[model samples]
Target: MKIKSLHHICIQTECYKESKEFYTEILGFKVIKETPNFHKREYNTWLKLGEIMIELQTAKISTNLNKWSSLNEGPVHISFLVEDIHEAYEEIKSKGYNNFKLKNEKEIYKVENGYLFKVKAPEGTEIEVRDQQEI
Candidate 1:
């Protein structure tokens, strides 16, 4: 068997409203489908970002941390690749998401590929935005 492509990523969020708004309003993902009572859960929202899809559902447990520790678990972070790093940074800044300190004091970090920055979602999930230099 061979895997073709990733269909979506599921995120369990404690606060459905905030998470929905964050992914839709802030991150510019389009809503494909929304179920108010999915499998007895509070909500299940399917969002699309370009070719990728994100499934946001009500979480059974609450993690009251400010942000999820990258070292603590299964999936570390979800990253989005952009064309312009500066433009993405400015856009995020203009939207008032200034709490982007991860690893270092600076917001954006330059890597071998390009540049990236991390932000915490409503459930403390790490959302990374980055740019890739053409090979």
Candidate 2:
């Protein structure tokens, strides 16, 4: 068997309202689905970053408390496969997101010609975003 690539990244947020704003408004991701947990009123947000899914689950839903409410731990790094990382940086910054920092200026990731950027979102979820291009 062979392993290919990542499918999605999961994130836990203490405040869904904050993450929703940052992910949808600032970061530019579309919410594809929002469903209640059936047993509980708490829910999850299924966001898409160019076909990639970022699962944002709240503390009320996440069973793994260690990973859910830990402020010390940041959201899981979601690497986007891009054709031009430089262009991505410009695009994101142009949208008024000025806090992104380029981690590797000379090198990129294996998938989608990705470039690493370390940034943060609302509620202090440190994001290691790998800028990627369209397929």
Candidate 3:
């Protein structure tokens, strides 16, 4: 068996509207397709950012994100590559997003390869925006 590349990341949200806004408006993801009543659920939206797509689905039952704790069984967080970390951070702040946790209390934290910042999505998902560079 062989693995090619990551196609998409599926996110189940209790409220689709809020989640859609966060991914679209805040993160600058474009809505590629939206299917109403998809798979016996309220709706399913496909959001694209560069070459990646995020499958945003509506959960039939209330979704518990586990508060994004490290003890969770699934993914701990989602990270995105951007051209400019400072621009992304400023844009997010301008959009009235203050729920992000900065590393070491710095506006833009330096990682092993590049700079980045972490923000909490509406569904309590931690999203990392990193500067575009080799990693």
Model 2 misplaced stretches (Cα beyond 4 Å): 1-7, 36-41, 61-76, 101-115, 129-135
The per-prediction CA RMSD against the true structure, in angstroms, equals: 2.8, 5.9, 2.1
lDDT of 1 by residue, 15-125 (tens): 788888888877899999998867767778899988999999885433332445778758889988888888988987788766675667788898887888887887777
lDDT of 2 by residue, 1-49 (tens): 8878767777766677878878887777899999777344377778997
TM-scores for all candidates?
A: 0.87, 0.59, 0.86
Pairs that collide in candidate 3 are none
Write candidate 3's Cα lDDT for 41-93 as tens digits.
78889999889899998875444433446578889889888888898899999
Two-way lDDT contest, 1 vs 3, winner: 3
Worst 10-residue stretch by lDDT in candidate 2?
101-110
Please list the C-alpha lDDT of all candidates, in the order they appear: 0.81, 0.64, 0.85
Pairs with steric clashes in candidate 2? 81-112, 81-132, 81-133, 82-112, 82-132, 82-133, 83-133
Best by lDDT: 3
The best candidate in terms of TM-score: 1
Q: Candidate 2, 122: how far from true, in Å? A: 2.1
lDDT ranking, best first: 3, 1, 2
For residue 47, give model 1's deviation from the true position in Å: 0.3
